[model samples]
Target: VGSRCGAAEFACRVNAAVELLDAGAPAAEAARMLADRFDCSQRQARRYVDRAAGGGRVVVAAEETVVFTVKLPAPLAIRVRERARESGGTLSALVTRALTEFLVRGQARPRLW
Candidate 1:
């Protein structure tokens, strides 16, 4: 486990988080900005923001990913529907499974610090 923040670092990060929030930034974005500004990781920035914003987890992991909404190409939509029907699933289920697979494969491996 990592060491808990020293009082000074904790105070500094909290102050930075408050400044960004006061400027009307969303929690996650503000955290990212604060991290960049203060040369800390995004996770540390999030911790700071969480502490300042009532001392709880301010960001959910899944919320960091992309979400897409658009009409699929006509032929692709038809094909997807047919496949879903064959599998006794809805188009949404098929899309979700596909997206999950895509993400799992596409994600970069974690780097050592």
Candidate 2:
């Protein structure tokens, strides 16, 4: 059901939504287009439009939590850190979100072993 990947993809959709607004399309019309194009719920599309028209990038809230230590290969770690930096989000938030999304998917593929 993930028609869009992450914030980057969502930003692209927001840009398109902005273009629609500039073209004199109603907010509802823009939301309808987003819902149709992204196969997301109309409610979700409307939320997207709200953020787009709200005058800035959509934001994620911070949570209070404990910290853990994990290790990864240098290259992967670097890439993840880079992505977090470029997105203006914390490494913890990004990794936590990704892990949560993956684990919550009941259909996550099983290993052959």
Candidate 3:
């Protein structure tokens, strides 16, 4: 994990992926290049390449952290994802900020039992 990848830089990678595809390069080739360039996992690089090749919307948000998973209500999960997309932030970031404020800053009110 590292600092967030800038929009321009991610876009450049996608653009390069597109160019590579157009140049008759194979999917694996593009993915390998991306992995080497970004020092990311092969799976993640393939994801980047596949998403770019599919002509679908792609967004990149890097955060410094370890993997932490918790189940949430479906609606809450959807809302968080939507907020991240709309705000160009990551779920990890939003959750980290919220937890820091609530637990560290002592700003959250007591919940009803």
lDDT of 2 by residue, 1-113 (tens): 44555665677777777777778889999999998998888888887787678644544334545668998999999999999888766697789988889887845777666
lDDT of 1 at 19: 74
Model 2 pairs whose backbones collide: none
What are the per-model C-alpha RMSD values against the true structure?
A: 16.2, 12.8, 8.5
TM-score top scorer: 2
Q: Each candidate: what lDDT?
A: 0.73, 0.77, 0.73
Q: Which stretches of candidate 3 lie over 4 Å from their true place?
A: 1-3, 56-113
Ranking by lDDT: 2, 3, 1
Candidate 2 global lDDT = 0.77
The TM-score of candidate 1 is 0.42
Q: For each predicted model, how many residue pairs clash, with residues at least 3 apart or on different chains?
A: 0, 0, 0
Which 10 consecutive positions of candidate 3 have the poorest summed lDDT?
56-65
The C-alpha stretches of model 2 lying farther than 4 A from their native spots are: 2-4, 56-113
The number of the candidate with the highest lDDT is 2
lDDT of 3 at 89: 53
